[model samples]
Target: MDFSLSGLWHEMGLFARLVVIVMGIMSVTSLLVVGERLLVSFKGMSDSKVFASKLASLLADGPGRLDAAADTKFGKDIGYLGRTLRAGLVAYKGSVHGDKDLCFESVARALERQQARELAVLKRGHGWLATVGSTAPFVGLLGTTMGIITAFEKMAASGSGGLGTVSAGIAEALLTTAFGLLTAIPAVMAFNYLAGWVDARAVDISEASNEFLDLVARRLADGPSEEEEEGEESEAAA
Candidate 1:
């Protein structure tokens, strides 16, 4: 295709317009991902905080009291901590007069399940974000290559093989690279930020679970009074 300078500019301008449109779409997509991830994270955090608080109170009251107390109403928003604590507390109740090792195992399994569920929720948009981040540059490069090739072909046909002849092609190529970066940067950043927060939350859940188990072990071994045990349990859960 023999493209004149004016023709190349017109074509590249249209291509730039397309890049802008894609960038706008990508921006919207990135924001949507951010919003969705934040909603999940905030819900998790809110639930974790409240559930941990309730469990701390229950632990102080005594292992015997956890069964009845765990069932009170938190409605649908009860969150991960509630679900996890309820399962563990129930297991502890069953084993209050049974094998010590078995109770620990049940609670451990419950905690693991909760962690897995939370992790699944966190992972929802990560793949999409990564995909966009990896592919945006290539898309831009594609457009740039097309524009440049068209410009070069035009110059070759005209037999005017000077910088002026190919300038539009180079310009189009540069535009594509720039547009690709514009689309990619935010997607990459959001993926990293959300992933990091999720990892940190997982660590917190682990620490809380470990402390609860240790509290149970201590109360069993020490034969502490209910009041003392309750206080210790709250601190462990806390």
Candidate 2:
């Protein structure tokens, strides 16, 4: 009895083949999702660091530059952080004559909305990876159950209790189980890895938003810069 790959493949019944095919499709889908997720997560992480540094520089100039950050390519490339900050900045800058508390509330709301949207973008395709991880094994088990049923049917039809008679079905059952696990393990690992990255990124975005809000609050409390005061005094003298 040959247990080589080719021999096992030859023993696989139609149901086992179908199971293998389904697993193959799942594997391909999971791989694509993993690749896409890695790209998005890495790019977001990289851009976020750049955005943070540039934002610090811009804020050092004063809160007046918060609105201007959105127009720059650095802000645009900063992914979630940029978008979230832009939302708050726009709200803060627009609420000029409105109540200060209202303005702060607006910025916080904007930050929350942008954060949710960006997190959704980061989490895209994660559900599929999770589905594949959880279900592939069960699907394989279904194939194994079918194989066992076929083995019993064959024994009943042949009226013989020989090991050779049942070996083929058992081989098919084992193959499906093997393929199932092979497809599932990587998907589960990738899902966990990507999920962790996303969570960390979310935390970073949230913290950055909080920091931006604090800066905005402090700037508002400090009033206009010396440059603005000097210009006002000059105009009065003129």
Candidate 3:
């Protein structure tokens, strides 16, 4: 019997074929997830940097500049940080006229909620990669177990206990294990890399949110600026 992949494939039983097919699907799906997550991570980082730069300039201008956040265009290009900041700004604006502590608390809650949501979005699809990394090897082992059983059955029927009688079967059985490792290693690596990126982004968001809260505290301490008062008056007039 030919021991090449094609030859081994032909000799494989139905269960073995199904195992290969399942592993193949898993491999393809993992690659797709890796590509998608890398794209998202990179783009999100870039957009966040831009947003942060712009936000720094706005904050430097004065707390009243927060009004500009309402006019800022938010979309995929704005990224997660922009969304979180917008949520905080919206809360701050709505509650700025209320009790100072209540206003701060409202902004804090908004930031926290948005941060959790953004983290969830960043972690999307990670579970699948983890599942494949952890389970692919076991799935392959299951196929190998079935192949060995089939081989032993053949040997019993042939009334042969020779190495040659079982060697081919054992080799075919090991093939699934090899494929399983092949599928799993890359998935594990990808999951680790993406997880690191997500962790770093989480830190960035935490720091940014904290800084934003500090800015809010300072603004409240100073009370509403003249520009903010004028803006409110104009809105009230309208």
- TM-score on alpha carbons, each prediction: 0.75, 0.89, 0.92
| Residue 193 CA displacement from its true place in model 1, Å | 1.1
Q: Clashing pairs in model 2?
A: none
- Kindly list the per-residue Cα lDDT of model 3 for residues 1-238, writing each as its tens digit: 8899999999888889999999999999999998998888788888988888877876787665665654566555768888888889889889888999999999999999999999999999899999999999999999889879988987998898888788777877899999899999999999998899899989999999998898889888987778778989999999
Number of clashing pairs, model 3? Answer: 0
Give Cα distance to truth, residue 17, candidate 2, Å: 0.9
Q: What local lDDT score does residue 95 receive in model 1, on the 0 to 100 scale?
A: 64
Worst lDDT run of 10 residues, candidate 1, spans: 63-72
- The predicted structure with the larger lDDT, 2 or 3, is 3
Candidate whose TM-score is highest: 3
Stronger candidate by TM-score (1 vs 3): 3
Q: Which residue runs does candidate 3 get wrong by more than 4 Å?
A: 62-64, 69-76, 230-238
Model 2: ten consecutive residues of lowest lDDT: 66-75
Residue 68: error of model 1 in Å?
3.6
Between candidates 1 and 2, name the one with more favorable lDDT. Answer: 2
**Rank list by lDDT:** 3, 2, 1
Ranking by TM-score: 3, 2, 1
